[model samples]
Structure formats: C-alpha cells, structure tokens
Target: SRSLFVKNLNFRTSDENLKKHFTEKLNEGRVQSAKVKKHLKNGKNVSMGFGFIELDSVETATKVCKDLQGTILDGHALILQHCHAKSDDKVSNRADKDKSSTKLIVRNVAFEATEKDLRQLFSPFGQVKSLRLPMKLGNHRGFAFVEFVTKQEAQNALQQLSSVHLYGRHLVLERAKEGETLEDLRARTAAQFTDEQNGYQNSTKLAKKRKHMDILDKPDVMFEKIAR
Candidate 1:
C-alpha cells in the first residue's frame, strides 16, 4: 500500500480529478486510486479538502511525491508527506509539529470553564479569532488555545489573563506556533468526527485515516466551526 499523504486540498477537488492530476504529474498509471476526505451530510458525501493517493509501489509513490510534493495543484498548496505504514497505527494524530502561529495557549484552565467563559475573558483585548479546549471523559484537559485576530490582541490578552482566576484556577498563558497545519487539521477534524461516532475521545490518540476502510471505522466529516 504505497501512498502519498496529501494536505491542503481545495474543497472543490474531486476524487476523479485527483487521480487524473496525479497520473498526469507522474506521467504514469501507477495511481491506483485517489480519495478526498468526505463528510456525511444526510447520507451525502461532502468534501473535506484533504485526501490520499495510492500508487502501485513505494518507489513509485516516493518518486511521485518527490516530483509533485510542493507543486500547486488546482491552485492550492499541496504538502505531500509520506504515508505511515499499517504497523504505525498507534501514533496519535495530535503529535506536535514545527508549524507556528499567534494563538495563545491558556493553561491551568478550570475543569468546568466553557467557551463562553474564555471568550468573555479575552474579548476585551480584541476579536477572538478561534479557540480550542481539549477534553477527556467530560473534563477539560486544563489547557486551551485562544487565537486573536491580531498579535497585539493575543499579547494584550495574555498580559491581562496572566494572573486571572477562572473556575478557581489561575490561567497559564503561552503562544502557539502555527496551531496545526492545514493538512493535519483537516485530518484531525475527520478523526474527531470519527471519535464522536465511536463515543470516545483521547485528544492525543485520535486516529488519522487509520483503519478507514470501513464506514464505521472512518467517518466522513468536515471541519466544524471553531465556535462554541
């Protein structure tokens, strides 16, 4: 199963289009199949803007990846990283990477604090672009990310929130680098929907297109709005 893990795909790109483009780029018929991650909407498959391409062999896959990895396909940046082997199934999808951003990390979060509480706390500084608080067994992981529309807003919020108490816990703040890569984020979004379907969430152990051959095993889901 030699494949290329592609990311940052445009929403309009279809499976047939992916196969055709890769076949042309690689100048061969080694592409066995191409699939875009999809979401289930009233039983319909909605595009989730990321997918994979299967080639005939690892050498062909590697050569195709090398030839097309960073090339713009259908007007979007394509990050063609190597696909992991089936034996690597235990690797968590949330493992950290080097991508950086201006999102501030708020730690020591109150176990019961909600998104509203976080928005209220940071709103005075500026528009809160986005926020994410991971949970496990219905309890906050004691940390979250609050992204401001501007760096100054994030800085201001961090300063004001440095010592504030919420849910009876002092907030610890820091910056996030690139939060999550667009490709990984899409895969993460799909993995979250799959977790919700499975009625479990580890935040750190979510599967990424792993064991996706079955409908029950891999849910087709789009990224949810990052609002509460």
Candidate 2:
C-alpha cells in the first residue's frame, strides 16, 4: 500500500500541516495527499488526533515509515506505519481474532503526561487501537491502559517501553491481566480513591496556588498530583 497511517497527531494539526511536516520539515518525499481525520462533535469539527498520508509509491511509504516513525511535530511524536491492504477478507478476519490479547497496562506514567504523549510513546510499536488515561478530580491517576491492534504489537510495546522514561520517570509496562479490560482497570482504580484522599488537600492547595498558571500557556509544569 502506498498509504501510511499517521497516529498521535496534535489536535490542532491540519491536513496541510501534516503534508508540510513530511515534505518540507522531514524532506522525505512528495506527499500526494494528507488528511487528519476529524468528526463532528458538539456541532464542531474536531481532530480525531490521527490521520493518513498517501505517498508516491510503496517504496516511498516504506522509506517514510522507516525514517519518520517517531519524529516529533507540534510537540507530539508521530507514529508512522504502512497501511494494511484490505484486499484479503480472510486476513482481516484473522486480525479481529488477534485483538483478544492486545491490551497493556502502563504504570508509573507522569501525571502530567497527556494521552497524546502516551500514544506517541506506544504507537511506534503498532497501531494503537485505543488508549485510556484515567482521570479523577480533573487530574490523571499516573497510569494508563493502551490497546494495540494486535497482540504481537502489544508485546513489542511492553518490551520496548519497559525501560523507557517520560518526564524523568521510568515506565513500567505489563500485559493486561488475563481478560482485563479498560473498564475493569478503571473500576479497580476507582476502588482506591479513598486511599488517595490523604493527598487531596495538598493537591487542592497546589492547584489553587497554580490556578492562574495556565497549563496551556506553559506546557512545562512538572508538578503532578499523584493519585495514590
């Protein structure tokens, strides 16, 4: 396929921006077309934070995948992979079965890390099917669950990211417990809410002090409220 799946895009990234990043910034090759997927939400078009790019040839797509797999753009790392051909229905069916074991529990995430960051961190191993960074009281709980499109991809991420660091903290990656889903993890974490209340007063004080500090304006704030 001459198409490449581009994931972990910034929400504000546009189709033209995506094309320019590849053609101008990276200088990879001519982009035939670039599109950032968007959907109507609350009567507004919102970026789905992923996109597709069509290059000149399969060779160009392969080169792009190799050279730009983890390139950062607009503060979000890009994940590039060759799009799978949909000609074989049997292969597609087989892929559906592979989803059973694709979930991973990511531990020790920096509470300041956003979904985009986690997606950028994991999408290089494979297409991320979905990701969840559970939040409580307007703050992330310092972990996430990521599901890749295939079990092998999930395993690859687990192995590669186990020793990786984000925001100066080492990451702990493990396969999701047998038959564990994101909802189950959410429930488990929710059960621990009472334990986290001990720090709630401190977090609240810090939040109040920093209320005027715009996280949107200064993206470098490192103080993250630990869930427990």
Q: For each candidate, what is the lDDT?
A: 0.64, 0.74
Return the lDDT, model 1, position 69.
75
Show where candidate 2 strays beyond 4 Å.
1-98, 189-228
Q: Write the per-residue lDDT of candidate 2 for residues 1-228, one digit (tens) a residue.
A: 687878778989999889988997546467899998665455777776777899988888888888888998899999876555333566556547755578887878777678987887677567998999988799998888888887666766675455455665677876766666789866765565556765797799888778756655555553443322
RMSD in Å for candidate 1, one decimal? 22.7
Per-residue lDDT of model 1, residues 1-26, tens digit only: 38666767776889998888888777
- What's the residue-level lDDT of 32 in candidate 2? 95
TM-score (all chains, Cα) for each model: 0.38, 0.45
Best by TM-score: 2
